[model samples]
Target: MSRRVVVTGLGGICATGANVPEFWDNSKKAVCGVSVRTLKAGDEYSITLPIAPIDGFEDRLAEFGRDMARADRFTQLAIAAADEAVRDAGVDFASGLGRRTAAIVGTGIGGQTTFDAAYLAMLKHGRKPHPLSILKIIPNAPASHMSIRYGLNGPAFAISSACASGAHAIGVAADMIRSGAADAALAGASEALLTYGAMETWKAMHIMSDELCRPFSKNRKGLIIGEGAGVLVLEDFAAAKKRGAKIYAELAGFGMNADGKDMINPAVEGAAGAMKTALSTVGAFDPAGVYINAHGTGTLLNDPTESKAIRDVFAAGADSLVVSSTKSMHGHLLGAAGAIEAIATLKAMETGVVPPTINYDEPDPACDLDYCPNEAREQRIDLALSNSFAFGGLNAVLAFRRV
Candidate 1:
């Protein structure tokens, strides 16, 4: 028999805020968190780009003590977010429940900082790297550290599907609960790729924007790289209700597919298919009333492709459907984007206020839709969809309904 899953707790840290509340507050206000930062390529050259980095994260490392010294920055952010999520859920993992809980995290470029440092030490400086470099640089370190921290013994793993990593992680974790593989799970994603090497590579790709992110805007150039983590505690619906947990929203459906055609370009059919599948899983709903947390990367291709996908999926209701990209405010969190955007979607449902796509000046005709631009809207969101389309044509869509 299949079970239903619901979100019980949410915890995240990003450029906008340190936790969910702060993140939501700043999001609702449409505050731009992208700022200029200097990244050193080695010891000689430095490049400046607008990035959304979590401030003061180094000071918080002291809370975890010596054990964290060996973990990478990405894993550190994941552990901190997970700690908040566990505490918020009020789940006592030590009381036999730990055996039934799992940890699944996602990362696009995990431990880039550690990798960059190790490469520089060995190749650039002709010196031996740190002994723990391997442990710190692996993409699965976040999931492993999270599992070890909470003593969770159930299925634990990491997903790394470019930008879709976070949503995929959450979707897979929910599937485990529905399949009775686990009663509950800590699921989310983390990214700390704000290293010089990572920045240089992104720059080489010609996707890094110098100005602020302007999703759906005609003058929009590209995406600004950001780093952070977002996590949620998902529990079985019956178990959560029995424990009197405050249910945020029901994770109603999840759908994903690959575009098979291109590496970086997105396909309209693929995006539309994912959205259709997710909504189909939960039966019918008023398409006009649905809101979309778009994977709007402020790029020329993604914005219009996503817009066309929504139009194709909703057809007549496309004009009434509201879509917004909080990435315009929080910047793109890459692997962590979907998880943080999921939290924003649920918060919008809870508060009856949809966050806006800031920096939208002139909308392109190709991307014509009701993008809640520049200001928050007072609307009741009965159902919402969060879209994540990655570089390798991987697409994941999640559906949530107000409980």
Candidate 2:
């Protein structure tokens, strides 16, 4: 028999804040976190870009009892977020519950900091890399660290599907619980690729915006890179209620599909299909009441394509649905984007205020919808959808209903 899954706790750190409450508060106010930072590329060239980075995160490593020099930035961020989530959930890991718990994290480019440091040392400084570099640089290090810290013995692994990684991780964790493979799971994603090398590489892609992100706006430029982590404590619904856990929201359904048509370009059919599958899993609801946490990267193509997909799926009801992109404030956290955005969605459900998509200059005719722009609106949302469309045409959508 299948089981139901619910989000018990949320933890996240981003440019806007170092925890979920702070992130949500700053996001609702449409406070922009993108800023210009200058960093040494390779002792020769310095690069500056509008990027969102967490400040003073290094000091947080001491709380986890981890060696700051050994742990990769990504892993540190994940551990911090996971610790906050586990504490928020008030789960007793020592009560043999660890055996039935799992840890699943996602990252697009894991250990980029380690790789960049190793290469710079070897190529420029003629120094050999640290012996533990391999362990720290691997993509699964975050999951491993989280499992070890929390004593999780059940299924533990990592997903690396670019931007969709976080949403995919949560979906897979929910499936594991529903399938009775695990009773609870720590699921989320983390990314810390703001190093000089990583930024230089992204600059070559020519998609970095010089100004702030403005999704669904006619004057939108492109996406800004951000760094942080977002994690949720997912538990079986019945078990959570029995234990008197404070349930945040029900993770009702998940849907994903691949375009299989292009590497970077998005297809409306694929996007619409994913949304339809998610909604169908939980039966249909009034489309007008659903709020969408859009995968709005403020790019030239994503906004219009996503708007078209919403119209395709919801038809006339799409005109009443509210859609907003928190990325306009937090910047795109890459693999961590969906996880943080999911937290934003849940917080919206709890608070009855929909966060706005900031920096909206002018509306595009192709992207006409009720995008809560510039200011937070007072609206109670019972059901919400968080969309994550990755660069490789991979799309993942998650459905959440207020409990």
**Clash number for each model:** 0, 0
Clashing pairs in 2: none
* C-alpha local distance difference test of each model: 0.91, 0.90
Where is the poorest 10-residue window by lDDT in model 1? 280-289
For model 2, how does the per-residue alpha-carbon lDDT over 219-284 read when each residue is reduced to its tens digit? 999999999999999999999999999999999989999999998898999999999888876766
Write the residue-wise lDDT of candidate 1 on 1-403 in tens digits.
Answer: 6999999998888899888889899988888999999988577768788998889989889987676877999998988888888888898889887899989999998889888898888988898989989899889998898888899998998899989999999999999999999999999999988888888888899987899999999999999988888899999999999989989899999999999999999999999999988888776678667899999999999999999999999999998889999999888889988888888988888898999999999979989998999999999898999999999999999999877
Q: After superposition, how far is residue 8 of candidate 2 from its true place, in Å?
A: 0.1
RMSD of 1: 1.1
TM-score versus the correct structure, for each prediction = 0.98, 0.98
Give candidate 1's total backbone clashes: 0
Off by over 4 Å in 2: 67-69
